[model samples]
Target: MESAETNTVSQDPKKQASYNTVETMEEVNDSPVEEVRLTVAITDDPTLPCLTFRTWVLGVISCAALAFLNQFFVYRQNALSVSSVSAQILVLPLGKLMAATLPTKAITIPGTKWSFTMNPGPFNLKEHCLITIFANAGVTGVYAVNIITIVKAFYHRRIDPVAAMLLTHSTQLLGYGWAGIFRKFLVDSPYMWWPANLVQVSLFRALHEVEVRPKGGLTRLQFFTAVSVSSFCYYIIPNYLFPSITALSFVCWIWKDSVTAQQIGGGIRGLGLGSIALDWSTIAAFVGSPLATPGFAILNMLVGFILIVYVVVPIAYWNNFYNAKRFPIVSSHVFDATGAPYNTSLILTGKSFEFNREGYDSYSKVNLSIFFVLIYGLSFAVLASTVSHVALFHGRTIWQQTKASFNDKFGDVHTRLMRKNYEAVPQWWFHGLLMVVLAVSMLACEGFGRQLQLPYWGVALAMALAFVFTLPVGVIAATTNQPAGLNVISEMIIGYMYPGKPLANVVFKTYGTISMSQAITFLSDFKLGHYMKIPPKSMFLVQLVGTVITSLVSFGTAWWLLTSIDYICDQSRLPPGSPWTCPGDDVFYSASIIWGVVGPLRMFGKLGLYPGMNYFFLFGLAAPLPVWYFARKYPDRKWISCINVPIILSGTMGMPVAKAVNSVSWFTVGIIFNWVVYRRFKAWWARHNYILSAGLDVGVAFMGTLCYFALQYYNIAGPSWWGLNIDDHCPLAKCPTAPGIQVGQCPVH
Candidate 1:
């Protein structure tokens, strides 16, 4: 998309600039631009009246039909392909379908012609969000985060959906606010590529190209028809006959079982020693950290294999087995430190375990404790970097850039490309507003989610403290995802402050802490988007809608999925350590107890908070020092320490196992597909490929909906359909008491 014409040589640097020359009078006259804005471009008016009833109905039906067709055709064309073309295949055809059938207007695209626009259909952010929310409810209803779900279900727990929405939305709002301040560096800078948005932009470009081109017309229709038919088949077949068909997960299963060898087995028997080596927590850490990115697979593999089997499991058994000569297995009669039956009859009943378990009684206390320590240390390090970065480098620059940006956007078009020179929101006002928002939300959450059981004052105090503590931490997470978001440490503080109220701790962590943290993160992303020429106001509204929708939908789906799992426990192809089954709650609990007791002790005593052998503290202080010193010393070296070392190290080490398998699989399929299309037909592939991919994603998604109903909801035999035994996968307590064996006896080696 680069401009073909080159700038002529000029003696003056200012005059020699390309795209700077004004149009000649004759040329300007020759170009009859139909619609133009003096300062900012407008794509139709924002205040266009809503469509009439007839039009609305027609639009909705068209959208549904299109959505179905898109999913069906998209997956049939090698659904597992990971190439940009595959993504385009999913976006283009859908666009073409809309263009061919819907009403349109001409719109100008950068570096291209004034293209015909298709109806965006009846879909808006609201509908997008709502659909996701319902999907989430379906997921959640069937599969709760086992322990947390069990606790809530048993307690007849009900969280206010509205309150959850408010908390998450507010956090996102804050993130946007903060992101606005850093718009210059994150958005305007060409080097700061948001890799995630690459997909969206590419899809848009590919789709737009085809929609505008006359040659793309027939292919587009084919795509639309394919997706429509596939969706219907998927929906009907799954609902009536099969149900388990989410295209995304289907690939994952194939990758996991047929392609990859990683598996989690049930009941006392580990997957060899390797089985004991992996768990959900470690999986999350590996996936989310830089360790799972490209170029880091080998390191992750070595680290993951070593840490899980050797370090973690051994350490877990240290106090119980190494010290007491006890084994990994615990007895049903054994009462853990809390005085509750560690493996009680309460859990033995499948009916009871499905409904009742409260908090975490799964992992050894030591494992939990380590998790607590790690999260706390990470938080401290994050806080340190945020303060150091802001105070030493960013403070003055932020103010100047913000003012310039404001003027550029509204004052002068000339200032558009230049750094935004605007003042940041005053710190006091910014923080004060955050506190006020937190306060209102905290009260509302407590009132709505009775399960939180938080005393009003305590809830307010915990949130206020969390907000205050998280500001610096949040800043670190905003700029770098490797943030110590005070998750573990914050839990500790809440645990102590609230004292004995686990559910309250849960609410605070989920809503109170995550909300504020996400707020900063979302805002940063927006700032990044702004630099890429996306409209700020639209971005804001879209995010608000997306967050609200995702929250409700994700949560709801989580619930539904949990219920469905319960309904068909055996038939599910889900792994034992799936997020639906084994969630991140363990980390939450460990952090709460570890910090709740010890963090406060450090304050009163001579020792500081987290005093002894504080590797995290050392890491925090040392981590940035080297980077800062290096950056200062070598100014001419280009970017250095801005890439957080720990994050870099983790990412570099962890990429292969998490990503390589998927990447390789998709690549293999893509190469074959590309060859087949290019060689088999004399027709050009580039023009039609994008529309084809779009058709695929829609088709897949449509099939996914069908799979959801068939496998998950409408199965005739439920868990018994495939003769899969829940007893094999279900936790020990939930399984029937073993024949000829005492309930409390440990398994023999």
Candidate 2:
């Protein structure tokens, strides 16, 4: 699990030489002499600050102050007054000050006496990429937006802050620990090729290889001075003063105006109608491209949103969509005029809106077409993953070769940095135990715990069923969602089939096999890093720390600064619309009820198995098999990477506008910092690129803290017309008071 490179770097040549001589001499004199070896030599490097009591105290105090300030000045402002701006913008700039002031040591080039550290901060490139991707769509993806919201909504009274915090830290530690146990399978194996790590390493190496050495002390001071000033400016500028995005939407608007833009625009309208049909494969191809411009996938999603906002609700206009007394959106349920919701409709809306609050809600119902498309994607995922796994790894040949190769090259040194497979539970047993605990917790924590309660046997059955079902689907979602938003349909199935048991449903559906799929995927990536000879233990520890921090900090901030009803009502009205709605969940629930009931009824009223959307997902699930088959058949072909079509297709649904100042800003950070590192320490960077990439991530994250506030905390409102105050009474027509639209304007042309 550790890298041989680290062992080599950490080894003390003089001490090791001395010990080797002593041991050799003793052995020469006495054939059976038992001897010890010296591993390192202690030396005082003034800049290599000790991690002593004082450091710990200072670190803790500073972090606590930072945390409290963030919570009070930043988080509280948004939570209380619903502000349009915040101070986190100010806070992130200070990170630059910290980064510059913190002195770091430089390692001497093999024959020289100089050293360097790239940047200071808690995150780095490899760290950020893995952390963000995971948080967004990897194993821990579900833990992001919705999970936190649901927990807060459902179990506010039961959730002790202390317990929640403890649980979070505990789960995180456990995740890290579990990763350690599987490090051999996941990290050191050459075939794993964690491409993300490679990317990080590349960035790091590139930065250092490009460093320009200073001629003298004055030049060195100037270099330092330049770095300090440039970095500070980089850290603060885009975050506070600039507006993110100059509107990339225009690129699609002008060039692809006819088909791509018009088609996508039509798709957005279709979304409002609740049925989206598009060629998944084609969309996948388009999205896989780096920019992911306004292509087919965007077209499909846009149509879905449009149909809902412009058509569906407008037709229901005679019915008051807002006033509980007149035109409540749900016909089956009743509510108090004050907007407090209850009953089946309330349950549906609450759950739906939770997904909404998490950013999955849409104004329209999904037509049968999207439902089938979802099913097809799901089916393809299952088939593709299974066949891929089988073809690539039958009888552990790949695994064995990887292990042998690593052991032959750098295994001994790695053994010291990363522990060997230690005493830990196997994957199956650990998950099995997890299921047991989850079931118990669900029963106790949920409102439905007391009612419609299945017997213990039923609980067992649910867990078993969830485990079995989550495998193919979870893998599909991972592969597909990695590049696109196809998981919405899969989620729909879970919502409707298990309706009312969102807690159990979400936990089971998301956690188990999903975890397995991600483990495999990331393990593959790690293998890539291993092949490239990046230090394994360094990669492992840095990633572990970064993931834990992002989860705790990012999730917490996202939860606290969540949008309110007004925000939702207003945001939903925007022309393009809010990302906060759960159209997928709505589609799933509606399909589940429609199919679960209708399909069975048509087939003679058999209950417990709806299988309608499941079949569609199964198609999606099977779609990948052929592509994978061809991949195996032509393994050497360059297009093999296209197997990630589904992911590319689904992921671009929400690529933060590249033109956004923030987006442009981060890329700027990457460009500038890499240039600096390249100019100052090119050789060292080439050698230790992984760590350097991590350093960049830290720097970027330090900078991002500002934008997070400026964008997320204060200015949560949509464009004015997008807010709730719409002019529904236009003389020519009337508009509904739902999210997204100004009264006088006809919905988008």
Candidate 3:
């Protein structure tokens, strides 16, 4: 994988330097996994300067820009993750132009002999990966800010700015602490290949690698440019012109008058049978590009999705399990016993915001659709399955890696190269940082007038849960590109232990889940660094700086919008077509009410309407046993090991927030590319598969941003017509099946 370049000391300040090394200069990348060999290039230019003047300038600029834009769009309806792909593509020319134009002069430290130059050699892939790392930091909007947003905007409570900053820093940096501790297991080992980073690696190489045009086919760069333009042009129709095409449920069109048909076929609210999405955002926005995911993982996810949505949910709903007939078949919203929308105001204790037992006793109990309840149940199952699955499949490898990492005796060439070239991050650094962050987090909850309401023990419990789940979940994510989240589990635990404290529950969730998520994200970035051969010290510094800047920018943007805008999140008061409806926060607000204000005790406990959901935890604990047993029983069959129960249990992970169409389309697309095309057109799939995913992602992102700022921002909507809105044309899907139930515009059942 080495490029046609000479290795020498770079005395010239305008060129990168490299040292002589012994490597098997094979025609292919040397790796244990086939995907890594096909995708990531195993090359290194150790002397290439990573932290140059342009890196800091562009890194900060990209971080601030991404943080601001992501925070801005998060409140809007149908928010998609504005990924670092947008920046990875846009930053190449800016960095090169800076390198080509800036004067090559060395600046001396005032009182020391140290000197550095602005244009230290050419703009290399290492610099680009670092900048993208910054973008990664900003792209993930501060999760703790959700706690702040729900507190101020939804709960109408005051929170100190200092406390808010503490919350943000503690959660994100706590994850960084975990990342430092787990680097040997997650980053140093070759087995933990993060599937998501393949897209980034492919895109960076396609943009930077010098390639001659083949006889008749387009090069990687040519393919990416063409697809990006085409995807950009094609997105307007679905994004603005005809939003209905995003989810095409033809069954609803065929039988428009039948409630049962709509309930089974509606793409947004129901099972999404035979539905397809023409829009890339509709497909990739929720679960990511199927092209980037492995075929086995997708198959496993499909199994779970089918078992739950196609099998269990229909049976439960039709039979009126937990009074499912009182509400819509599948919905994100909770309801009262009579099927009216559940209002948090009716069950609150006024300013104290605690659950009122008297008020609750007088009102109807909270109810959820069968599908929503199953999602929670499956989440518990996934958590349990993740632990068992990893123990069965990856436990021995992890133990070996842990021991070998102590002596720096990694077997892979990539880790060997990194060890010989760059210094490793010390274990004590991570340990010290973890202690500091843990202390700060405890103070954030305990201080601030006890406004957060979470006790010190709550923080300890959250940390313990995250610690227990982090390694297993990290292994799942590294291999499958999907990790079952801790949000529901943490919420359930906190709710049961300390009920009726909305602020407390959300804070606990943010701390517990976001920290582990952040750790995995950082570990993924570290893996990217390993593949790109960037310095470990440089990657560490870049991540820390980027996280600090992103937290500030994201929090500042959210606070400004909340304070300055009148009726920003209030949908009723705002005019039509307003993008400030705070759709994502609205869901967060609902969760706070369900888990915090009302508490799970009133919803799923003994006194609650549905305690059967608790049994799912035990079910999840046992879900992986059969799969593991069979894999062991049939040692020659390779496919049995890939039957991931955790992935299956978490198959419908994006429901309600993502809609059924998103998951269905993702499965459909993933199968066609990873399973079908991969086996047939091996060469083309190897060269352009991840590139196509990147182009479609950035294309839709740019076009959507353009449409929002140029047109939708000023209240200028598309033409008034049937195709102008997100009308899935399945109104009957909202109807309940039990006899004599009246609600909304649905026909009487």
**Model 1 backbone overlap count:** 86
Question: lDDT winner among the candidates?
Answer: 3
RMSD of each: 12.6, 13.7, 2.4
Cα lDDT of model 1 by residue, 309-409, tens digit? 33543354344322211322211112233322333233222332221223333422222122223223445554455556554454455455467655543
Which candidate number would show the highest TM-score if scored against the true structure? 3
RMSD of 3: 2.4
Error of 3 at 6 (Å): 14
In angstroms, how far off is 131's CA in candidate 1? 13
The model with the greater TM-score, 2 or 3, is: 3
Total residue pair clashes for candidate 3: 0
Q: Evaluate model 1: give its TM-score.
A: 0.52
Candidate 2 global TM-score: 0.48
lDDT of 3 by residue, 1-749 (tens): 22322122232344332344534363234568787877766556576788878788889899989999899888777675678999998899898898889989999999999998888867777888899998999997799988888888876779999989899988988887778778888888888899989898888888887677788888889999999999999999998999999988999999999998999999987789988889899898768889999999999999888888899999999888998988999887778888888876778887787888888888878888888888888887888878888988888899898888778777566777788789888878778888999999989989988888899999988888888788999999999998889999899899999998998999999989998998988899999999878898888888889998999998899999989887878876888766687766877888887788888887778888878888988888888889889989998999998898889888998887778888889999999999999899878888899999999988888998899889887878888899887857888988887788888888887
As for lDDT, the candidate ahead, 2 or 3, is: 3
**Ten-residue segment with the worst summed lDDT in candidate 1?**
30-39
Candidate 3 — which residues are off by over 4 angstroms?
A: 1-18, 22-30, 111-113
User: Using Cα atoms with residue i matched to residue i, what is each candidate's TM-score against the true structure?
Assistant: 0.52, 0.48, 0.96
Query: How many residue-pair clashes does candidate 2 contain?
Result: 102
